[model samples]
Target: MSNPAQPDHYSGLLQGIGQRLHSARQQAAQTVNTLLVQTYWHIGQHIVEFEQGGNEKADYGSGLLDRLSKDLTALHGKGFSRSNVFYMRKLYLSFQNSETLSHKLSWSHYFEILKADDPLEISFYTRQAALENWSVRELKRQMKSLLFHRLALSKDKQGVLQLASQGHELQQPEDLLKEPFVLEFLNIPQSHVLTETQLEQKLIDHLQQFILELGKGFAFIARQYRMSIGGKHFYADLLFYHRILKCFVVIDLKRGAIDHQDIGQMNLYLNYFAKEENVEGDNQPVGIILGAYKDHFLVEYATASITNNILLAKYLLYLPDKDVLRRQLEKLLLAEQWDEPLAESDSNE
Candidate 1:
């Protein structure tokens, strides 16, 4: 006998049990995080109170915390060490006011930020981490290399504030550029040499990670898309539709450094898509040249006079060392800042 009804009944019961378990797990995690955040808030409040109460007697606060930590550890168990109490004091000092506190960020996130001495940079990274929901590892990497400072150097005071308050918004073309796109998801070593086909295949296989690396609003359209015109044929490396930009993005991958010819090719592709392939409501197509390396001087000259929708950018197969990339971005920004003056000087000569 098949016993069809019995199997269906059991499967339904199991599914209900699984759903209940998932709900319980989620509730438990939420409760734990809430309690932890509440405790940190109280800790901050107490520290402020102690300091305001004129406890200026030499090292009185320190002695009090040392004794309290021992008693709390004995009573409650681990996680109340003296060093952690110091972190609580620093955390309170870092965020002096409650208005700036975020309910979404966890205590662990603040603890990590408290390790940094720079208050401005700490605040910047904290807000960014909360808004982006970055993992602890991502926070560590960004903070260690001073990602905020690098970006701030590229913009004026107002622009810096905008970047901190609201992250990279892709309303315009320049906003889509990040000097180095972190590709740790690829799991490839920085030193490893890979062919263009190999890189393309890896990106396709791990398409989800690739989308994240490309930043927000990128949705994959096709890979190795074919195109034919009159007597010639060409294949685009990858095609993506950016939801926010409301445009088709065509990407061409080059294994080596980019040249002027590459820019011309991408421009041709953009023109074809803009004139022939775009749907009724679609915006003009944008083409990007993704090469392993690029000469910014040559690229600027190559793309400067052109009005078509095309951008040239470098892509890395692996996550670059943060310090090196930070230096590179800083140099690039400085050069861009002096470009107008340099051009004028050259014209006068």
Candidate 2:
């Protein structure tokens, strides 16, 4: 005769204690992290104050940092090396106001955010990293991918500014798409030939990285989503659900330059998805045709008739040549006479 209720009571008590301990540890860690960040900010402020307005170098600035680093290392152990001290000073200059400091982020986050030279770019990364709960490594990955710069290129100056002030806004299809979508993480080379099937497989294999490249809120649905109409079967290359938009995204891959046929096929897929797959409370399906190259003029004409959110975009095997991409975007901006911002998905067919 054992007491079943007593065992249950003890188990519940243990669980409660464990939960309390875990919460306390988390709170303590956050407190320590916040204090450390503030300390580094103050250290940076002091170092900058020693330098002239934190920009012009004083005569003894180089040696001063070295001496301070050595002294700090002796007092506080290995974390205070010359580079670390330099970064602490940088952290101070980057976020000058105490009010701007974040308790949620550790100093490691600041170390990565400080790499951005542009102030607005820094702000955008900071906002996104916090909003997305991104680790330092994710922050580094995004910076290397030139996420902020690519997104900024697609917006007017005001929109770009808003991105810095507020994180990404996902009200429309264009809000979530990035043009000339970077697939460099797939490890495919420019010289390496990629077929549609092969590209689709690589994207699945590197699904996490691909989702990051695709922007946020995309959940993979099927690789070759099959739909039939009038006893004829057609396979979509890839299908995804965007959590934010609450709609399906169908992507068709092409190895060669884009043609009208590819766009027409994507539109057909969108129509099928809308009719068959959509349920109550779902938005209209959006289609994207991804190809190696697309003629801008042809894409413009092809997309003129469609009211639905069908878009065409170029896919890069390797990371884009940033210089060339910048030039092309600028050309697009000038061509439009700043009247309408070019939507990332509003290209190709």
Candidate 3:
């Protein structure tokens, strides 16, 4: 009779073989994608050179792309539309160095990146998309949300450049914070009077998108995470573990402007988590008091004495105006007024 362990050993061998096959197939797909992207880049180069050989501006207006689309579609079929050809040309112009292209991103990702109006915006989205492993849909959403503008609003010129070059880096607690965190995905109208419970429920119902808004390294732990002390109960609105920071993040949602009491409660939650829930090797817990509005002076004074990793931010039900945010960022960079607070009124109710 066959040994009883033979089946187990055979199963392990099969598992290993399956994993290898999966890895090889992924590699093959990635290689194919990279080759196609490079091919399109070369095609763009050819188009540019052909245009240069004639009157450049004249050829552009003379429907070069329109004629090229018909010929290329007839020969190759599909994916050679005038708009796509225009994008391919733009792709080459945007990224002259083929080596700079990330293998992690597909042509679809680059197509979205090329739509950006500014070079810095393009670079920022490109780096962020690759590093965050964002899908085409996610990339589009982030672009619409004006994520680059949100992050750059507090940074100086050099800091803004760093964002474009390196994407959003999560080195410390503050790095993970964004003011007026966009909640458009919740489908909640701003005019509707929202309760804390309703807001929390909506966030839980759309946890995936919420985490995406939360940025990288956040893993949802619980909603209404409970803390019991002296037989009294306290519940955090949402609790997430940050893999990068090695800490628990407590989020407290407020329907309106946050008060001193809200800050103190969040502080209490941080202290309790640090002393009670945090295991060995875990860093200090972080607390974020998210609300519709904030009293800037109150926030500054209330948290002045508190020595904890706490962040206060606003949440909006609608997408922020890109022009307004962009203008604000420009002023911030030029002034290098890091201490100057951004106007919280930009979030439309």
Candidate 4:
């Protein structure tokens, strides 16, 4: 073989050079992206101005984009298509006088949202996407599934605005509970024979997407976390720490319907963590039982006796039909409203 020292020296030099080239490429990409965003912003501004006051003597402003697009494509390149020019105009109108426009949102993200017909909805998703630091793919998925509409249906108007504007706040116990947790990250089909072990492994493999699906502020703590009390040993499927809530979130995955015993078992896990394993400043451990199906009545009855912080929610392997979920949410809201009057009348006695 050749000299070992020579190989080591050459490898070190190659690594250094590779790192420098990577850094340079990243910087060049950032520079090019910034210039492109700025150019689009300026183009949008110019289009708006042209429409407002291009020439007072002649009606040249009406189809200026069409004529300009034709000439620019012929002379310059294909980037100045008529459709793209119209998007520029819409972009200016959409974000006029707003100071938040910046590199926080990429041009691709803006273009994706601009395809929406509703300006209000577009603005809402755009602001949310920027605040959440979502990729273009994530934005498209949210839009396709009508995440805003689902949240609006589930929460009150103020709550909806709060979630969209301030991001998810885990202040209250109820805030941690999402009716149907989105699991589009898991590529496994719903019909697949997926075991709990397989599901947990998949989640760990795609942990980043899992964290996103779990919402903000969640950091993975452990998987297959083991706990033993007395002669019995128990294991949690997944455990997370919510930074914002300052608590340990314990999740148990169940492939079938939830039972009363599952709630008790989860309570046991929570008690073990709270009394034994939790740090001095950590909040009481919260337990969530994610099952394929749950009987709402059984869940309420089982959880009612336990005073500890625990919740039972359903999980899906794929995105549920939005129309069906929306109707169900509406029905729940109507039932709550109908029950309120009866509850008030009963209390008055």
Best candidate according to lDDT: 3
lDDT of each: 0.72, 0.80, 0.87, 0.75
lDDT of 4 by residue, 215-272 (tens): 7788898998999889887899999988888888999988888889999999999999
Q: What ranking emerges by lDDT with the best candidate at the front?
A: 3, 2, 4, 1
Clashes per candidate (backbone, < 3 Å) = 0, 0, 0, 0
Cand. 2 TM to true fold = 0.86
Candidate 3 residue pairs that clash = none
lDDT of 3: 0.87
Candidate 1 clashing pairs, residues 3+ apart or interchain: none
lDDT of 3 by residue, 148-257 (tens): 98887646678899999889988889887785699999987767987899999999999999999999999999999899988999999999999999999999999999
Error of model 2, residue 204, in angstroms = 1.4
Instruction: Give the winner by lDDT: 2 or 4.
Output: 2
Q: After superposition, how far is residue 108 of candidate 2 from its true place, in Å?
A: 1.1
Comparing 1 and 4 on lDDT, the stronger one: 4
Against the true structure, candidate 1 reaches a TM-score of: 0.75
Candidate 1 C-alpha lDDT tens digits along 144-206: 545565455436556666776665556876565655445556788878888878888988998
**lDDT score, candidate 4:** 0.75
By TM-score, the better pick of 2 and 4 is 2
lDDT of 4 at 59: 26
Q: Candidate 3 regions off by >4 Å?
A: 1-17, 58-62, 337-349
